[model samples]
Target: MILPFILVLALFDFDNVLLWTHEISLVSHKIWFCDAIDIFYYLNTRLFLLFFYFYCLLPPSTQPQRKNSNSKMATLAKLLSSICVCVIVMLTTKAVEATPTYTATHCTNTTTYAPNSTFQTNLDILLYYFSNNISQSNGYFLGITGFNSVNAVGGLFLCRGDVATTVCNQCLTTAIKEIRQHCPNQTEALIWYDECLVHYTNRYFAVDKIDPRVNLNDGNIVSSVDLGRFNQSLHGLLNDLATEASGSSESKKFAAGEVVVTESMTVYGLMQCTNDLTNSECGTCLKNAIGTIPNGKQGARALLPSCNVRYQLYPFFTSSSPSSSGGMKLGPGTIAVVVVVPIFFLIILFLGCYYFKRRSKKKILLPSIMENFGDEFPTLESLQFNLATLEAATNQFSLANKIGSGGFGEVYKGVLLDSRQIAVKKLSKTSGQGTIEFKNEIVLIAKLQHRNLVTLYGFCSEEQEKMLVYEYVLNKSLDYFLFDPHKERVLSWRERYNIIGGIARGIHYLHDQSRLKVIHRDLKPSNILLDKNMNPKISDFGMAKMIDIDEHQGNTKRIAGTYGYMSSEYAMHGHYSEKSDVFSFGVIIIEIISAKRNALSLHSLDFDDLLSYAWKNWRDEKSLEILDSNIEKSYSYIEVIRCIQIGLLCVQQNPDDRPTMERIVSYLSNVSVELPLPQEPGGFMGNRTNQIPRDNISDQRNNSNTTGSSVNDITMNNSFPR
Candidate 1:
């Protein structure tokens, strides 16, 4: 009995002493040991002690004062022994119960390695290999029997002896799956199962070294009253554990101990390393781990080079007495020599490299192109153009030089000193427009470089002044002839067809082919300027959107566009798309064919709007009746019908039903293609009071003035002379 008691004490002392050593080493390293190894060590030692004590007290012959005692005393002793045995058995049973389980029959394995590799690529391969080799019939037996070693290098190993083999295998399998999933790219990784151990590495890992980088910190904050004392005690305890754990032998390099805080409370600690490490290496590892703790933290832990250390406010390990047969033995003066020197050098090297790399990469100045602009539209260098040079170019804003007038100002035709003819748009002094409009015109037009679009020459912005210069157009615009009666005779059918095609191509470029897909929200006849060759150039992209290809439509409440040409979706619902431009183009096409305005009037000799007139004519197969009188003699009947059909197709009620620019161009080029019937046009049933807004009135007037020579009567406007 005494021998067993002594053995139990020695075993307890061995673990306790190791734990003390680890605690001391942890304090030195400023690291905590709240890792898995520390938890396992603490639990294993307590359970062993409790089991040992109960086992020693079990035999009747071993009991003291057995023969001299009365029957009652003997009976009482027997009952006490039985109860102790039962308690120990129950504890062992519960410990096994606490461990997780795995069924070997469910284990699956697959080959994941390449033909040349020695190691398996994943956990499935390992399982497959074991399953095929170990069990041919009912799978491998489970419970404790499942954990025995099959091979020296790669075999099943159990950390908890009481765990069932089925449970151990299950735990190991789960751990293996988790590690593979989380760390798929890593060549080496490890995971701990409650009942078993699963680890794989590219190279063999030393089982004894507790890697110090993986320390765990308790998340709970320490209370102010006990913070200082708890920290001090924790530090002292962890350092001691680290020192003792590092000095442990090959069979076991683990320890558990406790330190009293108040009368009822004690802080328990545990420390450990893998058994493969040398005593010196273990000590060094623990010493490094101990130095990581700060002053006021509670429930801390550290994983060291050779061991791990942990301290907690409650006892988290199972308690059992140790067996009488064996206890670990250590030589005298072994602990002190194993710990001191190597730990001091590693700390110095780690901190130096961390701070040096952070200071080398940072920025200083802006790049060159942005610096030359002076962050404004008109720089000091650009304002150098003299007022005399401007006066000479514009002929002192003479009536002959004046081309047009707008809400903002009057436009004048000018010839620069270099003989470059330019259209100078000089702002009126009382103009409500501001510098923002000037900037917008400059920025928007300068970036647009399409062949069918007008080019911006330059701008003058000096001394509260603003002016925009553009390339001069010889023929005023399409509206000058298209909207006029007698002058419409000059525009042949061929010329009108050419103008329509040019406008479509220009709009196509704006909607898709340009660098930015733009929606020209305000396309009108006036906005289409005619060049010397009479080719139509679409202009005024100030209200255009640079849309992404993936986006379908956008909405805005701040509407800015001409009224008759605007799509119903855009006008009523605030939605705009590339198809909105298609709708506008349809209106333009009808206007070009009929040579008439879109406004509603009783004396117009047609329905309210061009869309309604066209739709009614097409349904009655009298589309050619709406053709302009000037082009009636020259236009082909088939071609006219084709144009009318296309116009109706473009004005479909549904935006999606409208043909894309590519499709429209194809339809126009191929006269034999069959066309689908048109649906009811948008805005077909609106109230008469809801006329296209006044903002759009200017666009109509401008169109009439520009195209007056080709459509309307050739009354020479005072703005620009032929």
Candidate 2:
């Protein structure tokens, strides 16, 4: 074909028609004349080629030339039409792909209910309300109904961080209707759309949840060239977004950003959570979501009830106008290589060798010892402190600087270069915590933020040393005042009441408000610290366990908590949950009221424990006996009685009978709410009969002794108060 076209041009040039020179000036110079010549020239060439090729294939037959010409023309026309149709289809498909599509839907099978059941009705109503609120207001809303009824429904919804309010509302409204169709009459359902999420249940749904989660992988693996570098950039980008989003205000918890993955490619990411969740909750939720992102996937999304995380190669978040300030966005820029390639590799090699050497020495790997610790805290480098700085502040951890000790480490009061007073927890060399607990306290407490919770400033790990830095509480722990005869007398009724409410709010943060649902297994009076103002701050989370917000309870073989504070089921069978924390809180409340330890024997020989003694006195209509004699006689009798009633309800033998932290906070703040009658306390009279040898008991009070392995630790069942 090339040769023939060249020959035609050569023939035109030989005839002096190529340049339309003076010899061709005699011909009309109309534009249509040239066009006609160009068309005829190409058609004549093609016709000649076709005729020659067919002639070579066919026998020299006498009269079929005209018929063959018509057939060839028809074949050419059909091919051109097919090409046009394919182009049209391709354009249409690309248009559809540009729009968002529903990702997934998860409907729990265990929560199946009747079509018209009260629970289902409540769920529908609540979802509708959420939809309405989301449509009219911003892109996030939480709805909860039927507080005390059997058909209680609690839920929340969130839209993409960068989506427009109108689009978010439309997405949520569509999801609400679609969820019902997909999981008809289900008591609990969670549905996800590309733009928003719709979730509701018959029970209260807290922010941190992992189950029924949906993981969507784009399945496009990254290219091997620069794969490691790309992954490193992607992770750094997502982690920054997660932190920023979680730390955002309750009104808007969303972040979006992009990172230069390669010279020609950029990775985009977006993270968002329901505004109802706390900063820590949002962080934890996003961390969990990010953890579920499939390895090597170019694009992916992990959806949960409270949060959503996504990453892709192309920009998916809509650009917001300057007025909206809709979401956090990472500014575009090239990621500078801070470390040399060879040096980076050497660092990794050294770290790997160090880790292996520790393992060879029988030291537990931090990740191996704690389940889900990585998910709870994905990065700790930002919070790490220098051991040298801490030593200088604490005067080389001298005995003079020693303020307290606990099952995990020794506490030393330190003064920073800036004259900031801080408490340093130096992990004992032979302590059972090792790397796991040392990391746990740092990760967990650093994320939790509440006025009633001790603040974690930072942590240190250097030269075979691990220490946690905390804000020092000047007034010491609650036991300093509550148990001492002289100090106990100074704790007036007002102070005691304030202390109780503070403790309740702190525990409430742990159980419900914080990013993760945590059970502080050891909730004794000594574990509560007092500020300069005598306000209580919950401390010592070494024995704490983080669970899913929706989880009812958990079990462990090793029980590590105060005997009097441990619930009956937890003490004997290792069963625990938020309810276990409630039971412990109940014991603390009783101790606070009476100024007497729950496990210690009282003057009366009729009861073996304070729980039993408190129950007997309350049953006999002598609730005043449960109050501390140190309290002024002019105290509010109604408030004291109500507190006693609530404390008993919390100590119910059945964990289910115990009220939640939310309800406990309400009970403490609102006196008009009627308290339920107390049931027999857990392990009321069975302690004496089931008492184990006291020799195995190890006292953790006043921060004494370092914690050992969970299974090796002294069981609380064998440890009773003297």
Candidate 3:
């Protein structure tokens, strides 16, 4: 895709054009170490063509396969969303700094391998693979290296989905370089960061491990007169995000928003999981993270490997729109012109070449691919419906029948001959493009029969199309109304409360009572489909891997997210369980209440936290948006993410969220208690009200305990001296 562009640059005497072309020519053959990935990684993508061309030229082998992929349209939405904002990040050049903030590392001293041994050699190979071969397009990678099972090593790297590509690359580079240094000759090393997380082992690494996390807090409890109300607001925000984030695309398991406690005070929070994780895995990780938020603290964080959750009085996460301080956001139209047109042109350019030669795209028949699945693939026999039947039921999914659309796909209202009402979700994808493995293991979701959960009747997988059939809910999605400013009637407070209870009931059934014990990973308003009585029915079972089952794909296992308040054993050896859903549940309720209060300019920044940036004034004015009539010093929502913007540079998290490693993160949070406080405030550092810029924030109230805590963090997995 970029070869033509490179040739054009060659005539103009661009210094690197000739060199890049020679490398691109090798793609027809098996290749290793292509410069295309690098050129794209560090390349400033202001000229949208450059970004489009890079992906167009990206080797098919390097492109990530879809996990729990429902349809192609949803995937394309995620791709475009990330690419457009990443273009903004590349232009700003701020997300390139700081990054890969260190949280904790676990090295298995008990399982040490001698120098130059087979195990050590395997570990080296695994690290090498991570540094050069991981996909920059995604924040998560899982791979294993070994000639034999006796000495194999497995590793995974996951950057916060919001961070820029450069930040992800840099974070991986650091993890690869220092992980060994941190635990020489150890058989295991699990290093977690604010912006990203990395872990590898010569032993087992399952899809979920909630353990050995670092719990940290500013130790300043909210001394407000209504502490309970403040907590309710905070919990309400996170809980909603947890539900929402779990339902997010597989490529991004993250959600953030703020809860307004009063005109002068607000609570900002975020929940995230590694993209490799299933919906249940992400929700569980976030739940655990939220559970340990150290109730009543002015600020708190649950930092772990599977998922992470945090909340602060001031802005701790990045909101939309650039602050006066750093970074910049481009309007959607500008992004379209910059990123879309070039892509459209490139598609045409490739099509012409393909028609003259042969069909450039290869189509894989669904039936043929299904034959390759082993016995482990669940029986789709009775649960599988034919594509033609669905088309007939939905009238070929005509516009009149189309009830809704999203990144996921179109929801068409359908009626069967038996007068049965249904909703047909059609997801399209290109055959022979990207990994095409269908997660048949998810058949359990169809068995999830509950009153609060939308029943999954069956599925249809055909050429270029994957469809899910569900019991139709007449009221549409909760967000369809919650986020619409022009909706005529407002939801009654009692209705809102009932909706929350109904959602809780659905999740409770999935987690504790349903025949299939699963987690409804995406629990946000959009996935909460309301029925006739305004009772909530959770749809889109983005839930997780089945419990007590050993799944194997290649030599690796899926991995993800983190948070704190871990047991000593759990802390020493990373293993976690379900988090209290209370914290995450709190935020959604607040959004339900303040649906009309989200008219901030920052919303134009295009990040997805629906109830965001309302607290832009809280960063500096300390929620004095009312008391301080002058509004002189109040800044915007620039707390951005992963807590290391103070100890670490600003790049480890999503570039869209962070300004270019600004010296001042804001007066929202100070994470000096965990990481070394940077002298220059080298990255983002927002503090709370009544808090100062003094460097002693990291010096915990109990100095003696703090030092030991930091030291023990490194050897948490029983690597410490007895």
Q: Pick the candidate with the highest lDDT.
A: 2
Residue 312, candidate 1: C-alpha displacement in angstroms: 99
Tens-place lDDT digits, model 3, residues 1-722: 55655633532344433223222122133222223332332232333444455466544443557444445444444444444444454345422266567767777678788875656655654565566555654777777755346877776788776666776777878877888789888877777666677888776654355565667797777776969888888878989989989889656788888888987778888888767778987787787777777778877877776677777777645465432322234466755554565456446544544443332132344344355344524665677777766765666676666665433345577654334567776553532211121343236555667788777777776665776777777776676557555455567655665675566556556555655445332244555677778888766543243443221111112211111111111222222222212212323443454453221221133332222232332233333232212222432223222221221222112222222111222212343434322222100111122122224112111111111111001111110000
- Best candidate, TM-score: 2
TM per prediction: 0.43, 0.46, 0.34
Measured on C-alpha atoms, candidate 3 has an lDDT of 0.51
Query: Candidate 2 vs candidate 3: which has greater lDDT?
Result: 2
Instruction: List model 2 lDDT by residue over 453-543, tens digit each.
Output: 9888888766667788888887766665666554533577778888989999999999889888888887887778888788888877777
Candidate 2 Cα errors over 4 Å, as ranges? 1-378, 486-489, 601-606, 684-686, 689-722
Give the clashing pairs for model 2.
281-515, 405-703, 406-703, 407-706, 407-707
Q: Pick out the ten consecutive residues of candidate 3 with the lowest summed lDDT.
A: 713-722
How does candidate 3 fare on TM-score?
0.34
Alpha carbon lDDT at 163, candidate 3: 66
